[model samples]
Target: MMIQKQYKFYAAHRNEELNDKCSNLHGHRYGVTCFFEVERTGSLTTLFADFDDSIEPHLKREYDHAMMIHVKDPLYQTLLRHMKETGETLRLKCFSCPTTVENLAHQLFTEITEMGFRLNRLEIRETDTSVVSYTREDWVNDNRYFASYQIPPSESVS
Candidate 1:
């Protein structure tokens, strides 16, 4: 069985080096849809988890009105440290990659995966008509999980 949930939050971000445009600070009413696939359980209960109880709080705290920062940016690091020292309650994101819609989708996917949920897909809508989708398929083939698989002896014998 598969269940999907959607959430929205307003966030501000900028491309650290996008010179033409999107380099300046801008805000977006971002929409996020998270897909989850659960094992078949024999029960009448709802397969989808409660948004308010399970997901809303997280979105509210982490993303709502927050400044999404690309961690690799030296400027972001400087600002983050200054904010921390000043005791500012700033919701910041330290991303290893650039702060783009595509990276945002990947980051969300990673977070959901880390939380032990079987994530099917994550969609980050940057605009009403534009969005980026990241799926578990992208990460499943990554070399990070190579150690988890054991090679059969037939191949090794050669």
Candidate 2:
């Protein structure tokens, strides 16, 4: 079964060296939709996991009204370290990493997966007509393939 949920956050960011209008700091009211594919564990009374219970809180804290900074930005790097040292809540869009839709989806996918939930797909909308999606399959197959291996049963090997 597949379950989907939508979230919104307001954030600001810029490509520091893009040399375009986008290089000037700006904000957007962004929307993100996540689709989760669930495999049945043969449990009763559930078609899929609860979106509220599984996904909402993480979205709120990590993305909502937060600055999306680039990890390589020296200023952002310094501020992030200061925040860590002082335990201060960071300003929205004040991130230590780039805040592009691709990066956002990548980061969110990792976060959700690490939280013990399988993320099937992620859709990030920067505007009503502009959208980007990242699928779990894409992540697993992103030029990092290793040789496949399998173990045969002991009896079959004998």
Candidate 3:
């Protein structure tokens, strides 16, 4: 059996690898749909509520209303400094690669799968007209960019 769930998160990011408008910081209401395969246990494969319980917290904690920036982005340090000096709360999610939609999709997929879910497909709507789709096969075949990169402690001043 297969089941699907959708999630919405608002986050700010920029593709530092680009030279266009995408390089500027911006926010979007991203829509994510995840398809999962499960074994039928009597009449149900899994409870939708169970999915929500496991996934929602991760999204809220890491992505919702957060600023996702590559650890190397200049803004990354500036934002951290600002938050620390002012003692303000900023939900900053740092990444090792450019915060493009494609990378974001892959990150989410990896996170979800690591949670013990049999994730088969992931779709991310970066905007009303733009979407990125990813699957386990794609992730496996492609070079896992920044997959093992870790942010240095000095970079996280806050």
Best by TM-score: 3
Which residue runs does candidate 2 get wrong by more than 4 Å?
A: 41-49, 74-89, 92-97, 141-158
Predicted candidate 2 versus true structure: per-residue lDDT over 28-128, tens digit per residue: 78888878777767764244446656666766665566666665556566766787899885664433345567766766776677777767998888888
Better by lDDT, candidate 3 or 2: 3
Compared with the true structure, the alpha-carbon lDDT of candidate 3 equals 0.82
Question: Compared with the true structure, what per-residue lDDT tens digits does model 1 show for residues 1-158?
Answer: 66878889998889987886798888999999887877765764244554346567767766788778676567776776777799775667555556788767766676667667777888888899998777888656532443255421110000
Residue-level error in angstroms, candidate 1, position 55: 2.6
Q: What ranking emerges by TM-score with the best candidate at the front?
A: 3, 1, 2
Per-prediction TM-score, please? 0.77, 0.71, 0.88
Best by lDDT: 3
Judged by lDDT against the true structure, how good is candidate 1?
Answer: 0.70
Clashes of 3: 0
lDDT of model 1 at position 37? 76
RMSD of 1: 9.5
Residue runs of model 3 more than 4 Å from their true location after superposition: 142-158
TM-score of 2: 0.71
Pick the winner on lDDT between candidates 1 and 2: 1
